[model samples]
Target: MDDERSAVFRFLRTEIFPGGEMPGKHDVLEYSEAGGFSVEEIELLRPHYIRTVDTWAENLRANRERAIAIQSDEVYDRYLRYLTGCAQLFRKGISNVGRFALVK
Candidate 1:
């Protein structure tokens, strides 16, 4: 997903850039920018998502038995692995997720 998102960003950069190092023009910016959020608010996002993902991992862990019961063991394990991979990425700061609003 991140790779695909990066490819989209690359496409946008080509369309938006005039010639130099930056975009030609813009009315808004990424969430970390002043137009989208304050520094403190941006700082809060990481820990908030960490806690959120932790809760999700806990719920998935607690429901493991039911998961396996409803599905095959392989499917259940795969789901758990997927959750763990996501948690690890966020926990390690290797990835992030956010809402991108491009307003007219």
Candidate 2:
């Protein structure tokens, strides 16, 4: 539901700040290609992040379509803004995990 959507949304922001908290195992604080999670954790979280993007995109599209039928222009506009903001996450998701690709 909303919680799942929020979880995915936060990961796409590209930086950790403010709350100063993040996901990790065994008392670790962070990870990246150049940081804390180590090779295995990085490999694992990478796929999960991509999957989360795909999930969020599908849900957002579905929700927006439904909203189009009975919602105001503002709702439509907001979703469009959201779509733009999420472009990076979507592109990364598909390139990293989606099987089909179009060459151009």
Candidate 3:
């Protein structure tokens, strides 16, 4: 499941993000400045992006919990490895979005 999560992000980056022109152009400009957006499109995409993020977050939370719940030490350690791999993907995604939250 940990590898699965990384695969999801990889798919999002390589496949879904570049699969269309909208997200491509949206990346460079403030979303508001990107033209051809009706109020309705903006409204729809709001929930869309929110829901997508929610799904991603939930998957990460569940996988982390699943890893911690394994009883055997050996199995637990394996899950911890998976957890680290998942963390790397999350960190990469946050960086990709230019969301450096700790700026002083």
lDDT of 2: 0.47
Give candidates' CA RMSD values in order.
10.6, 12.4, 12.0
lDDT (0 to 1) per candidate = 0.55, 0.47, 0.45
Error of 2 at 35 (Å): 22
Quote the positional error of residue 84 for candidate 2 in Å: 6.1
Index of the highest-TM-score prediction: 1
Pairs of residues at least 3 apart in sequence or in different chains that clash in candidate 2: 31-37
Model 1, span 28-82: residue lDDT tens: 2443365554333212255567777678768978998887889877877665655
Ordered from best to worst lDDT, the candidate numbers read 1, 2, 3
Model 3, span 11-51: residue lDDT tens = 45554455543243245344534553323232123324444
Candidate 1 lDDT: 0.55
Report how far residue 84 has shifted in candidate 1, in Å.
Answer: 1.5
TM value for model 1: 0.51
Return the number of clashes found in candidate 1.
Answer: 0
